[model samples]
Target chain A: MSPSERHNVTVHGPADGQPMMFAHGFGCDQAMWRFVWPAFSDEYRVVLFDHVGYGGSDAAAFDRHRHATLDGYAADVLAICDELALDDVVFVGHSVSAMIGVLAAAARPERFARLVLVGPSPRYLDDEGYVGGFSEEDIADLLESLESNYLGWSSTMAPVIMGNPERPELARELTNSFCRTDPEIAAAFARATFLADNRQDLERVRTPALVLQASDDAIAPRPVGEFVHDRLPDSRLVLLSATGHCPNLSAPEETVAAIKTYLAR
Target chain B: MTIPAALLDESAEDLFETAPCGYLTTAVDGRFLRVNRTFEEMAGREREDLLGKRRFQDLLTVGGRIYHETHLAPLLRMQGSVREIAVDLVRPDGSRLPALVNSVLRYDEAGRPAVIRTTVFDATDRRRYEQELLHARRREQEVALELQRSLLAGALTEGEGLELGVAYHPADKGLEVGGDWYDAFWLVPEETIAVVVGDVVGRGLAAAATMGQLRSALRALASTGFEPGALLEALSEFSRRHELGQMATVAYAEIDVRLGLMRYACAGHPPPVVVEPAKPARLASDGRSPPLDAYSFWTDRPDASLQLPPGGMVVFYSDGLIERSDRPLQAGLDELLASVDELRDARPDTVASSLAQAAAGTTGSPDDVCVLALRRRPART
Candidate 1:
């Protein structure tokens, strides 16, 4: 399948506008950017897509070997950019995807103009001098929580959770398949996300970045975000007053404001 | 048993405190705004200890905190309400309480997320049940894998002037055993050998079982001195009589190395490819018939013969060899032909591995892929 089809690429905004691609994190699909992407749609060419095996992306395109590492997801981001012929792109990534954007930017620095990493952590496990705020046991417990929540992921209930109030007809026709990833794929993605150590990739990135850290993020705490900022050659950190990991969802206004301020500067 | 209006009014506060399920209200950022008696009891803490002092996430295990931040929080923001989220609540003594949580994100008059109202249900029993189901599914996968491994463990036929190689790759997505299998054994030891690649319908343990039955039936029928066509005809009869492996596809070939002759027949399968010395590889599409138990009007199964020149090679493979979701079958076949031609100089084993690797590119095949290559050694230098 073509990369566009494989990733379920969706485009919005003016054709000739500067490209702004939003990448969602581990827990959800492109829908995670619903509140934030619209804020940029007027001035930027917005691109949104689900990662393989998530949301609207073709599940068959999920190759276990390819997606076993964050590099594979980084390759997919580049593939999307290549398919759309996007350049000077402004990438806004959440949680794990923030690191994906990091990898992608480091691989091809010229393609990206700026990166907005929301709640990013170069690594989730604590290192010798760094504080990642989680232990190996914590991630294992998260996997167990995912196991017990399979009932919430069932086709019957996923539709209810993913329902589009404005388009009830579309919801009915989707068979509740949106975000219906196989449980195995979910676990593999979790491992890849939580276990990844991309601290060194930061040095290779030349693209100027904005780090949007939540005030009390349980995932990417303050020090981790500061570490990402310190590693990147040209980056600024903005700690959002919003608590929790997903400031985009909890405080889209603040998230958008932070990106707007970064781009304007 | 209806209560009086005055009594109902007085009992409203009692209902909130003594509800069957734990109920609480928290600020949008999870700071406890209010808690009922039931929620306090379930959390093993008093309202005074929780209210204004801790966020709901603080009451969860570390993993539950991460899950709350990642999945639960975003889901509540998007859907306005989330249902039946599994989490573990940490009590003061550190004992874990498996809980099912549901929360609604309520917006205020200014259209801002003002508060989150949540209900918590004790799910120790439900959690155990889910764990059992997960274990059972994994056990089933293991059993299917074991069955497939034991069945395909037999050694292939090998001898002087004959080179044989086989590669089998199961579908990688779920690690479920597929129906595709390859078998090579002596029909008349040292003189002629039978090499077969077949695909039974479906997957999992049942498909593995069906593949085993069909493999045994084909071997048994070949031992009766039946020709390639008759062997398949009998196999189809076996399938119909016993109601197993219906619509299974097979490509059966018998090679007599000394005589440089091959009798082959394809039963609803992609024809085997042949590459002669210094000649381009071509598909042997001559003898073909519908799948077993297809119930076609034409009952006759014809076998075709090919003169295996010195240094010639023949490969029998399941449909996965020439079928992928991303491309047309003809395209895949063309690629296979080109690949065989490119790898013509390689050994039989190298060619088998290379072809299988090429077919399963970066993304593994959804269906199992099997390749069995047989080459007649070139005239001794």
Candidate 2:
């Protein structure tokens, strides 16, 4: 399949503006950036895409072997860049996508100009000397939760996750958007997201980067974010006051401001 | 009708406290603003502790919290209201309260999100029932797979100057086993061999059972020295008499190694492929008939014979091999022919395995595929 069809790429903003690509983390699709992407659309060519098997991307294009590891997702990023003929792009990745951006930049440094990682974590499981919040059992529990909830229940919980109880419409839109993903695909994505270790890939990213860490994130704690920043060669860390895994949904202003500052720098 | 003044004067606070369901209100970001007495009792938390200190999601389990962020919150933001969502709320004591929740977003005068009103209902029994149903579905899938495996287990006949290969792959999308089967067996020791491939209509256990019956019946009929067409005619009669194998398509071929002769017949199945030395592979489009039981009166089915020189191969396969949703059947057949042409001189096992792989592509197919290849080699001096 063509990259456009495989990734469900959507381009907005100006044609001549610098390209800004947003990759959503696990548990959601490109719609996770609804609040954050619009802030950049006025200045940059904002690009939003659903990973294959999520949102509007073609599920039939999902190959188990090709998507068995984070490298597969990195390949998709490269494919998107190549198909659009994009160069010196600004890539914004949330959660696990942060590592995906790292791998993509490491593979083709010329395609990216800067990297913005929102709530990034190089490793999810606690290591010997590191303080990644969750344990192996916790990750297994998370996968079980994904399996139990399935896509059928996504409509019910999407609003709560989006944290916009006031604007139920936003929650409803997100529910419909993310719930369309196949449950098998979602489970596979969960396994790929939590079990991944990308600490080594962090050192290879040469692009100037920004790590936007949430102050009280349950998924990726402060120490994990700091660990990522310490490993990254040319990256700065900005701690947001938001208190969850998804600051983009809960604290869009803070998330947007951090990205803007990084891009300006 | 005059009502008692005391009954009419019940306080609003009393009504709110004694409501049937738990009720709460939260800020747009899920911070607790106000929770009713019923909600406090249901959640097992004091109102003073929850009012400003906790969000609705904080009361859920880790899994529920993830669901809250990923699906529930997003749905509520987009649709304004969500109903009948099951979540396990963690009580103060660390136990779980299985509950069904419904929440609605209320907007302020300026059209901005302001607050959320939610109701919680106990759903312990419902959740148990759903779990039971899920377990039963998985058990059924396991049983079907086991049945299919036992039916397909067997050994093929091998001898001098004769080679045979077979491949079978079930549909990858569904949990149920498919009804495609293949068999290769010796009819006359060191002289003649029979190869058959068939697809029974439908899926799951019934299709598999029907496939097994037809396969066994074909072997029994062929053992009586019946020709390919006569064996099919008998099999069709057997299907009608036993009320089994309806609408099944099959191809049967018997090859005589000593004389290098091959007789084949098709019943609404794709014609077998023939590959000769220094010649392009071609479909043996002869001795064709409708699928089993398609005709009320069983007639003598016609049979076609071909002169197979040394190193000649005949390939029989089910429809799934040349049937794809994206392309026409003729195109798939042409592709299969081309694949055969490329591997014409390869071993029979390689040809069968490679053709199956080519038909499946990178992503496995959604239907069962079965292929059987038999080759007649030069007779040993």
Candidate closest to the true structure, highest DockQ: 1
Q: Cα lDDT of model 2 overall?
A: 0.81
Fnat measured on candidate 2: 0.20
Q: For this target, which candidate reaches the highest lDDT against the unseen true structure?
A: 1
Please provide, for model 2 over B246-295, each residue's C-alpha lDDT reduced to its tens digit, 9 standing for 90 to 100: 88888998888888888889988899999988889999999888888888
The TM-scores, one per candidate, come to 0.94, 0.87
Report the C-alpha lDDT of model 2 over A122-212, residue by residue, as the tens digit: 8887788877766777667666556556544354663353334235355345434555456667777777877888989899989999999
Kindly provide the TM-score of model 1 when superposed on the true structure, using C-alpha atoms. 0.94
iRMSD (1 decimal) for each model = 2.6, 3.0
Lowest lDDT block of 10, candidate 1 chain B:
B357-366
Note the Cα lDDT for every prediction shown.
Answer: 0.87, 0.81
Per-prediction TM-score, chain B alone:
0.94, 0.90
lDDT of 1: 0.87
Ten-residue region with minimum lDDT total, candidate 2 chain B: B357-366
Over 4 Å off in model 1, which ranges?
A151-180, B1-10, B296-298, B362-364
